[model samples]
Target: MSSGAMSQKMTCDKSQDRHEEKVQSSCKQSPPGHMTDLGKEEVADNGRPEKKCVEEVQSLWTTEASGSVKLRIDELCPQEPITVHQMFINCVQKYGHLPALASKRKEKWEKITFSEYYRCCRMAAKSFLKLGLERFHSVAILGFNSEEWFFSAVGAVFAGGLSTGIYTTNSPEACHHVAKDSRANIIVIENQKQLDKILLIKDNLPHLKAIVQYSGSLKKKLPNLYSWEEFMRLGLDIPDKTLDDIISSQKANQCCVLIYTSGTTGAPKGVMLSHDNITWTARHASRAGDMQPAEIKQETIVSYLPLSHIAAQIYDLWTGIQWGELVYFAQPDALKGTLVNTLREATPSSHMGVPRVWEKMMEKIKLEVSRCAYLKKKLVTWAMSVSLEANLKYSKDEEKPFLFNLANSLVLEKLRAELGFSGCQKFFSGAAPIGSDTFEFFLGLNIHLYEAYGMSESSGPHFMSGPYTYRMESCGKVVPGCRCKIANVDADGSGEVCLWGRDVFMGYLNMKDKTVEAFDEEGWLCSGDLGKTDEDGFLYITGRIKELIITAGGENVPPVPIEDAVKRELPFISNAMLIGDKRKFLSMLLTIKCVINVETMEPTDDLSPEAVKFCQQLGSQATKVSDITGGKDKLLNQAIQDGIARVNSKATSNAQRIQKWIVLGKDFSVSGGELGPTMKLRRAAVLKMYHNEVETFYRELKK
Candidate 1:
């Protein structure tokens, strides 16, 4: 949904009687627990060089349930901190002078040291106090991933309040919905653009107390709106001891952040996460990520992913604080273009991307390869085959056959560098399922890409590809502190992948009924995702239980994996929807990629001469990207036949084959309501929106 569609301005400007949770800290702090999880390296009182925190005398006993447990990430680290603020304080004191946060500004990288970051965080917290926000209240963070954003969130934490992030792409109405539900008292916005959104629905948010913006251009227009500087300036009068008192009184179980779910089926729910949730998760994540102790302070990572999601919290915010790692923030709106450039320039030690990022990168590379000269194309193809063959062997725990290393050094290594993974030691994917074909492409490039499985309920990923054991086709082993189990198995062994872990979220904030439904009686988080575990302990997802397509013969078919396979066969097919539930035969709905004029930036509803010739060879007329969906256009239908045939050939029965199919008039888009806010397909919504078109396919099948 576009901001314009919802509203041109933000909503809210009211006061409410807010309840504050104040902890009276009478008990003295323990004689400093064994190790602080806040990325602490003990400083010697006698000038002996510092070490990776203080080593304890406790026995390093291994757990009997090895399968459920993972390698200990940090034994010295505490299991939980009274508050995330305390965790941050421990880290800031240990690495006070180290670079904590950095961002690219005007083509230059700017940084703030841990000390400066702490100061800013303190000031930001004081600003909230200056706004008269009650403790335990929420401060909605509305902005791109930036230094100020992180500072503001941490500041809220210091003031003993919950920090909630709203997606930068959320429409104004969605923003209003979140604000209203979260009961956000103050919103720290990025600029006038976002400020305008709050203005649109301000009247509806009865609890919203103030609007604070980083930009000062609109200071004169809205008298109540305060500039970033002005807001922090208000905090100068707030004694530093005030924030210290708040942080000192924070409890471990208190809600520290409210992370909203993707809401594919309905309205997004606020997932309440406590301080322990993040500190515990980040500790395990620190080890699972395989950050060598030597590289803990030296490593640099880019923060380009959506900050609203749980993944960014673990890797960018919480993890950065835990390890004292340098974080580079990508420019807003220019993330795609500059991310690649910055990767090439900065050469980060670790990198992460979702499926869409890899998918688009592959499309760009393939397009360029198509235009390459015959000899160059042939050489590139042969080189990739060699790497792919080697990767296949390596994945099976076999050594590279012959001249494999030579092939990598000759063609693959340079290519990896070009795509910005040369220096990247840890490249992983999570959030959603990545296509097998896409995974292989990265493997072919010698870029060992791995997949992980988790949700907002798990505090990001409690399971990921560890350094020692990893499989290309499965989500890796359970991270430490998380016990994984497959429940209610079928004949095929597929079942709901369930988990119980310290890293799991506290629960939904306000939805009592939904909270009960999220987990089973045993407290295992019922993921709702259907999958099976292999003998090697690797987990392979079949599909969503709610999304399973039961054919007329009663055979269940997982559509996503099949759709991904079809795309692997034909790159032109943008998306495929397998329609066979309760039907005599299987069918599909596909939407091709959008084609636009390079210069004009308008939809080119005319196919290129070369493109037309390519489709002509497949017995289909040329069609533009815009014409492939939204209506009945058979011009490109035949062109996708080979791809469909490839999928059908793999099917076990006739009911699983694509007996009929059609191209949609548009992409499965978030703004179009075809996909959910998180970009996951809304099956029910999609079907309802195209009921007439979908029914026609079945009617034709009847004939």
Candidate 2:
């Protein structure tokens, strides 16, 4: 068929049929002259839309009339539309002998090739089918980043079911909400701990058919429960043709994965992502990041972040497959400190870290340096100063200093090698805004931490910073082929960031009203983040619209800038939360930097090495949080007041200045319900948790 003929046919299908109307109502129609960049005429043989498959997938999403899903395959995608199965097969065929996944088992790394990885996924898929996984049903995976987690997710998609990952930190009720919401047919868990959570709510999940534990021994055997080995063997007798037929029927436009939001405000909403959303975004995003193809050199990456998050899933699973990158799974206790160990061994080419991860790394490095010998400390400090000056000059397009190379060779390179970053080409930070302190710290070591900005609704990356396009405090340019515009711009040109591309998700699962609110009439995904773009198209996020603090005086203040300023002024501060929404004046809640119990992952009263040094420099003998808070050390108190006064001096207006502040006994943490799984602050939860403290701030002010 000719291009005109295909357009006419699609238009007729949209206008003449009721079902087509329903699909078109929810899906954005291709504008005239919108053509693929393949440089060849699209024909029916070139992966034309399959009506039945498209409708089947569209049925899973809920979208109001105002909302739109991008389903125009020919125009939106540069290459031919392809399913996940096809993408996986192409990767295996090209790099079958290459190492695809590596996992440490009993202190030895076990490697799996692409061919073996494909075989394992098929085995898992057949097992899922044998276990009675119905089409469109979900395979809910609750686990860490492991081979088992990868198998469960890919197998579910291969078996014609949606793969949904539940955060391991979720409580039983939270797990139940996701499982029931997805109508999960099978639950794949890491061990007995996750299984116990499911068992508590198994009776409530009507669609649940089986439970598979991938690690650890089961405490008690149940009829529906099976071990990983046992489950893989269940479908051995199942014919390959059975799974093949399911794969053949799958369409690129169909939903294959469900990523639930962190739900800072309320219950989590399931974000439906199509196969094209995964495959296309993976390919294009990799291109945007300047990732080399497997044909040239296969990149290596460490997978430690939660797979449930879109960023990790895209980078580790989809993008890894696209480029045949070797992915090494970190230990289950990766966040507790084992991550650097894995990074050292893996020597990955690319790595991604959340802000907290980078911050922790910065804190660790500083603490270690503080304990170094006097000469060594001074030498390292001098090298860092040289590197920092050079990098700052480079950022300003000025020539580097003459001693930069010497400093990098003598100290900076050694520091990076110690942190397992010697082989790292690109370092990325996302999921939360990284502080300027952390950014500058890494930059001082000649490490450029690229910042990316996006949401699950945009299939991970909308704006990405790269080596050539990087700018300080900017999220770089929009990903190749993606479109972004600031909506409802204010006087300062900051507004809600809107995105448009194939990367935009289908819609929310079973939430039409919410889905409608997600997109504007022009079919752009309305990112609730407030940001502005520079002349060079680098995006800078200011604050979240929902997180903006509106005072009683009707002044809207972005809390992040103020909070970050406070932390920058007071290096000992761990977290600073600006609170003045609908209140008389702005007040802040702060947490001092302290040691954390690795086992419990909880904050301890004992001050961190850096914090202790800060106190000593201020002529205070404080060693623990109690030493300062209880004893009310005049030096420490005065130091804090002076820091806040400095921050207040820079405020644009009096309304934005924090009037009162108090340090909390404990720091915020994910387990404590003050932060989400990604370490992003849950503002509503924090407010509710500290209601009394906030009330006291205002109450005492009146007194």
Candidate 3:
């Protein structure tokens, strides 16, 4: 079948009354002369299609259980499903000589070809098999992004086991939960620190059979613990056919990966993704993002984001493998401050950053610009205005001003090169809401940081912004072959964004109640995200259903928009969290930008360069957060009040306006439990942590 025909068949046409029936029928039918069950078609040695019994193909999607426990596989299309192993093999066959993974060792960089990567993965798989890894079991990797991490993850799947990633920052108890819940047969750690975490909880993990340390020497040798060298050698004696048979037994519909959500509100739930989910989403999403295949032009990407998150896993690992992109392993301190250094060297063709990452870059650039000579600063200011105007016009499909070229050549191009984004074709921000201030800041630099929206349950991205489909604040259109609907829409057309696609995960692992809650009767995954579609089908996320604050007057207010507005109005503010649930009026908790301790990622009292400059402009000598919070800096206090008033003046209703706010002494940090690993605001956690302060806002009102 042609690709277009397959896409049309797969896409759910919500306008038609028989759309649900069509979806059901598609899942039940077996097209003649086409592969039905196993993901992609099998080819014979003679280059013809290998035939399989229809009965065998039909059994792929079936399971012994009924009700919610049964895997949900709907909207089947004519395109055959492919396994992760098959995808890797296909890429190797086509780009075997191409660089697949690169790592810096000492002062030199080493590259591995696709063929070598596949071979190493097979070795890891054999090692897993030898270590007693069983079918449906998991190999949990706790470490930074590295070549070994990829090999272990892909190898586990090749050995008929699930690949799970434990966040490097997880505490011992949290790590124990993931390890025990997943029934991990083997735990792979990067260094002694992660090894120590596993050791502290190893007694609780009955299913854990082996532990492998991939980096650094073992602190103390113990039973069932092996070094990287020792682990790889254990599988050397295993027969290739032994591992091949296990790989062949794998099916496209079976769960192969377990992604645990970052528990912002509650305990993390393991998200189950099948072979088909990863394979299908990778192919379609790459196309949606206009990712060039290796056959066209091999792409390069620097992988630094937490691989535990679905966003990073899909973009850096699965998608990279799918397109034969060269994946460079960023240093362990990448998030601390070295990511830009890696970017400078790799000169990646594409980059993905969480909102916090982009925000930090913006602050860094702004600080440097603030210190520039008067004439240079003026030139940069003028160039930014020109580029911002041109880009805004371009987004609307309007002609760019003639001076755009001049500005790009003089200032914008150098800025991009300085930041090592000269070759970056696409810049993506996801995993959290990006403030419009940060979005516009990038636009001013001639960089279009497209926003993507999805959760672990949706594989990665259901809606994505690309060059042709982007809007100023919208998260772009639904990916091809996906279906979306806004449920329980309000008068403004905003509602819970429900999604259905090949990318939707099977179900939450061992949580039947949550799995059932995730989907409705029609098998659509309830995204739990409140959003609306524009006339052009672009999705604008208003807020999360869980995060929406209902005032005492019953007025609904989304805090993100309000908080973003306040931050935009006050350039010195680093974080603004709106609080007013069940209260008569709204208030806010604000934090000023301060110097961060790179070693510990803790906030310091010393003001950041930008903050210091802002205070200087206000004719204040305050340098520490304590200096401003002491109530002695009248200029700073008045400036903040003025900014908040300006933000309040634009409020649609009195209930939506912030009545009062307090500037917190310290900024929110992951270690402080005010933010998640992705740097997303933990509203519930924050409120609880500052319960005393929060009550003070309504103390007088209650009396």
What value of lDDT does candidate 1 attain over all alpha carbons?
0.69
How well is each residue in 612-659 modelled by candidate 3, as lDDT tens digits?
989998899999999988456899989989999999999999899888
TM-score per prediction, in order, is 0.85, 0.91, 0.91
Span of ten consecutive residues with least summed lDDT in model 1: 12-21
Model 3, position 503, has a per-residue lDDT of 86
lDDT against the true structure, per candidate, is: 0.69, 0.83, 0.83
Clashes of each: 19, 0, 4
**lDDT (tens digit, per residue) of candidate 1 on 69-123:** 1212335442434346555655554565688776665556666676566666777
Worst 10 residues of 2 by lDDT: 39-48
Q: What's the alpha carbon RMSD for model 3? A: 9.3
Model 2 has a clash total of: 0
Error of 1 at 502 (Å): 0.6
